[model samples]
Target: MEQELFTAQDLEELQRRGISLEEATQQVEDIRQGFPYLEILASASLEDGIISNEPSQEERYMSLWERYLERKDASVYKMVPASGAASRMFKMLFSFLDADYSEPRTEAERRFFDELHHFAFYELLNEACLRNHWKSIPKLLAQGDYKAVVETLLLPKGLGYGSKPKGLLLFHRYDKVERTALEEHFVEGALYARDSLGQVHLHFTISPEHQRDFESLVARVKDCYEEHYSVRYLVSFSQQEPATDTLALTPEGGLFRREDGSLLFRPGGHGSLIRNLNALDADIVFIKNIDNVVLDLYKGPTVMYKKYLGGVLVAIRDQVFGYLRQLDKGKVSHSQLEEMSAFMRDAFGIRLPEVLDDESLAPWLREKLNRPIRVCGMVRNEGEPGGGPFVIRETDGSSSLQILESSQINMADEGQRQFFEAGQYFNPVDLVCSLRDWQGKPFDLERYVNPKTAFIAHKSQVGRELLALERPGLWNGAMHDWNTAFVEVPLETFNPVKEVNDLLRPEHQA
Candidate 1:
């Protein structure tokens, strides 16, 4: 008798997608057991996990970063995850489209229409309305036909902005021109990511459907920025790999199937980007989300702090490399081992697991120093809807700095909820990472991941509720064992536009 759980065709399909039968079986097992919630020992604070620097220390880090940029062999790149669509940003507007009443019923919807002219895309929306509906926006507003204006802006007949990626949408307007989030990131890269040869390297993880649009936009604006900044631009794009897509399960834990009896697979979340990041060939990479940008006027602190984080990374890497060289020689004294242990605790927030005899110390130090390093910028939380920073004890009994989402926490536990609510800092997805080892070799990033950290989210497909598995988040579980450091960056450094109304904030304005 053959197994009916997975047929020969199913096995062939799995093999074609680079997924093994055992891996598929394990995924099924994971779905059965469900993901375990993360244990919260305590919230990482200014006193323990977060690094707050004085002005003098800031200057030193900046100088060090500039020196690192000037080094001949150094290669720096910026990676932005720009795959999310703008549908969520316009959720309220969509609701307005569906309302039975002629006018908006809620304060939020009324505010959107009352202040619609202030949006960066207002002119484009007006033009779209005039072109498609043969009616100008001002005329529609005069007649109290606000829905027509919104329809032209969001529907396919007009701008179709509701279906577009957030990166390509106009986010900020200046006297001369309006800029998209993608354009802002290009400007940002020129300011901080340029290397010794006056060249900027950038890679964007975009949806496959929007790759051509992104490429065309890059081509259109690259020359303008290059001329403006006197620097060459090398831009690249990647899509989420289909193989990373996870299987969906029905409400009863059975395999989800389409009407045609085929399996259902959904794109893994941002965690899948770890594979994309691992494939990049660079010494240093700066990772940030697409929407976390600001106007040029307020960009000074953001750019300054970016360099500060990079400088801190380079300084720490230099010391770690030096210590690695000393360990390689195998002539370290007891006091020297103690020094390395102290450095590990102070720099990475990791305590050496059970000190052994002298012979075992050198290998342990080498192993610890050889992994990839990342320095993340954390901002003080102010009622933001994002993950918080924490010190979590791993399965191996080693504790390290981690960025954790609220979903991962066991909110049912009173003590854990207290610590979670008391969290003082939020992860802004601002990171400066060193991917190369002391020997100048790329560290295999996949090895450091904690598979247990994968998330199973509740989602609906084809009007049916189902469970979806998301790979561990890139910063959260994806870099689980990397040497991590957290620096407290200013709130100004963490301006992200989660909703359309967020553009009304001062940071997004000219």
Candidate 2:
């Protein structure tokens, strides 16, 4: 039956992409059956799951993080997930290009032209305008030719920003020059992730087709940042491997084909970066989005919060390791086991099933305490369009704190819907992770993922609709089994440039 579904050429392509037959079959089945909604027990709030540390606790954590950095063997790195094009950021401008009348009709369109000179890329766009149309932006605007300027900014004939990644686009302006989002990361790494050895490390996950452009940009700017900051920069990049791509399927489990009659596959979302992250050789890894950056003038709060999260992770990690070492020696007293369970509750919001008595608790505690640790920085929810923290019911009848996307919930259920809506904080993709085990050896990062949490997206190829399975999100389910903690970070620390006009927000303005 499987042979009848996949032709010889289909099998050959699958082989080339490192996908096993069973894996492909399972993906089809998962897509057909659809993922089950996570059983959310309650929303995470300050009274239960989220942690709001006092100033004294914040200071102690920051100091502990500094001491950890001072260790001679420390290897800290920042991971920025920066793949895909920036076309979404230019959606409004793209519409303007095809509009019947082109004098900034929409509010967003008006804002773009009204604040044209305020954009960091204004000078560059003007230069492109002269080269492309032999007319400056003001000259063209004087003639009521707004489409000309929009064309020059997005089309290949101009700056071609509509096709480029956000990392390479100019994001902020300064006294000396403008900086791309990638350059801002270089500046940020120097501020917080730099080690005592004066080396700042960063890793970017980029698309293979844009690898050369990103490398060239890095080559041209790396030396200047090194000179300015007086710190050496170590950077690396990786593309999502073909093995991580999932096959698209119809709701009935039939394969979806492209216009040319070949099977269609899509990259399995950012969760697939777990493999790239597992390959990294850092003791401490900071995960952040590529567009969530600000100018140097607004970086103090961000720097302070990053250090605080790191300190929190290291402190908890040390205690976890110590308790695991004790459990390893065996003969743990009943009181010691109870203390461990209580600490687990206080530290991670983990609650074991009451049915497990002293005998069962030892092994359970060992299994729970020995996993990886991640400290997630969350901000107060202010009507953002993303997931929030929740205490979800795990398969084993225990409860764990997880950052859940709306798609993972059964929104139709009134109880779950209310719990989700009641959430007061939002995850900002700010994280500090410890990937090593108690003995300093790297854990098998793949073993911790909750494969049942994958998301099936509705997409189109050649105007035909199909469902594409995205692996569990990196922070959402990819790290589901890791010991997770949440810290309330200042909203000032999150300044993501989702749309072109968003850059005009005060957070993005220096």
Candidate 3:
């Protein structure tokens, strides 16, 4: 059967649902043009399972200690995507402009401002406002409604900041020596890798507009690492043009339409980066938020855990490759097949072994034992951030381990509530994979991705208060059918700088 294309009626229906005629027409055109690459990506699969359990708890600890004694070497890669604007931080600037020193702010207002000042960009704002001589600490409350002033003097040129990328926001404690979030993350990556793994590859994904700043930051990182181990930097950007108007949908189940009649949808989420990641083609990839990095004093345990995690992944990949080669030679015997299937079901955490309904394997790995693949987390001191690990039973009667995202768990469910309270385990910044096999066959991403699960994000708008946006994240939305496993790493490995105050912590200051 052929797939149906959008028809004239579809356009009419879209317009009735709130899309402008122009946007409806454009959507129709885009549908006709088709996204071939996306379609291909949506169709790939990973049938062969990943390697099953390897070292036990005792064995792993002993192995790591032994490896440390031998000075085992590993490479570290850190990817920081610095493309988002600092829109949230703008709220503080507004508060500053609207302050009134004469009457004094109420406790509530003062508390809010203090919290806002904690952002990483606060210092940058202070410096920019100071440089422009925009009234040294003007009495915000006494100022006659600075709304107009803000619009006219600030927003038009990127809020009085450099008007460059938000990643370029400067933080200088003394003299001219300054640092941006970009520099901080790069240094963190370099330090962690050097102290733990002995070598590191730090890459930043930036937009074309910020190329110069990105290059400058790279140079600074190189200089800092000159006395330490080797460090390499790779920079790349999406060729797609930036959107002018923010895409949004209307409240009446209608697409937000412009006077020009263009239909609107929120910019597709970060999962769009999966294509960019595929492009990197590195042997190993470490994905971390641009703002998340540990400072010097706290670098030891974090680097150690990163290497251990990477080492485990490398070892698993080696085992998977070896198994695939065995499977390629003639028909796998019943005993061998049973062992492989058992490993997949028990250790790799695969859930759909019976999907093929091969009678030959039914007697071995039972259906009820099948579960969704997941990475088990073991968190050490410092604890873990983000979501904790939990057993997830899919609708298909199989269950696997998964990381928690506030949006995914049903708050109303008693079982989910219990799991949440129990605090099963922390993610510990480690992952499982079947990306490549022993025979070097690329694991098909489409086959493993769970199309049914997703999360919707609520975003704040300039005029419109809040809007919902849907996008896929790596943990819940990015994984596939390949059996997965989880291992624990030290909690010190996950130092993340979510706010500016975080830089004041002993780790970052070092």
Look at candidate 2 and give me any clashing residue pairs.
none
Score residue 390 of candidate 1 by CA lDDT.
Answer: 89
Better of 1 and 3 by lDDT: 1
TM-score per candidate, chains pooled:
0.97, 0.99, 0.67
Question: What are the per-residue Cα lDDT tens digits for candidate 3 across 1-510?
Answer: 011433455455454555555643443333333221110001001122222223354357435433532344333346666666554434444555566543325553354344534434455545444555454324332454333324333464434442445566653232334567666665556644442434556666566666776677666656665555465544444421232112345444334554555544554455445445545544445666665555444556655555455555545445445455556554656676666666555455544533544454543243222222333335532444465555565555555555555566665766556556556345544542334434344444444555344444445444543334433445545553435566655455555544334445545452
TM-score of 1: 0.97
Candidate 2 Cα outliers beyond 4 Å, as residue runs: none
Model 1 spans > 4 angstroms off? none
Error of 2 at 247 (Å): 0.4
Indicate which candidate wins on lDDT: 2
Better of 2 and 3 by TM-score: 2
Q: Which residue pairs clash within candidate 1?
A: none
Summarize candidate 1's per-residue lDDT along 112-218 as a digit string, tens digits.
Answer: 88888889999999888888778888888888887888788888888888999999999999998999999999999999999999999999999999999999898
Residue 244 alpha-carbon offset, candidate 3, angstroms: 15
10 residues in a row with least lDDT, candidate 3: 36-45
Q: Candidate 1 at residue 296, lDDT?
A: 94
Q: Relative to the unseen true structure, what is the C-alpha lDDT of residue 273 in candidate 1, on a scale of 0 to 100?
A: 94
lDDT of each: 0.88, 0.91, 0.47
